[model samples]
Target: MAISIFGLLEVMLLFINAVAILNEERFLAKIGWGRQAANPYEQESVKARIVNLITAVSTLMRIPLIGLNIIVILYLVVLG
Candidate 1:
């Protein structure tokens, strides 16, 4: 149960971090993901891709976690 809670927290952190990265240029640059481009369009393109990747990974991790939580809840309710 503790581990499951920890996993949920980790997933939540990932989502929060991803949002921060998307919203803050300085934060993204601090992590070296904010790239310098010759044009504004190119810079936006790279930034969007990086943000999308982070969002995808976090969402993918979350799906399995949600399933695990549902399974655990069902088990507890049905068994006890």
Candidate 2:
């Protein structure tokens, strides 16, 4: 059914988003902007703060997205 197809598509897109987020984190770390390298002086920079904020928001969003993906997969399996 169309609903089932759409659910599958959503799952694929969510998976891609998760991968992209991971890649973003990796890229940030490679560029010396990772969360682990935080220091008092590093926090003073507007650019560093902005990057940290964006990373935090993306990571938070990813949690709910992963849960939604699981729920969608269950729904598709049970009702598709």
Top-TM-score structure, candidate number: 2
TM-score of 1: 0.29
Q: By how many angstroms RMSD does model 2 differ from the true structure?
A: 5.9
How does each model score on TM-score? 0.29, 0.40
Q: Write the per-residue lDDT of candidate 1 for residues 1-80, one digit (tens) a residue.
A: 36677567657755655553363355655665544422456645766677556556555655665676576568668975
**RMSD versus native structure for model 1:** 7.9
Q: Which regions of candidate 1 are displaced past 4 Å?
A: 1-57
Clashes of 2: 0
Query: In model 2, which runs have C-alpha deviations exceeding 4 angstroms?
Result: 1-16, 23-25, 29-57
| Pairs with backbone N, CA or C atoms under 3 Å apart (clashes), candidate 1 | none
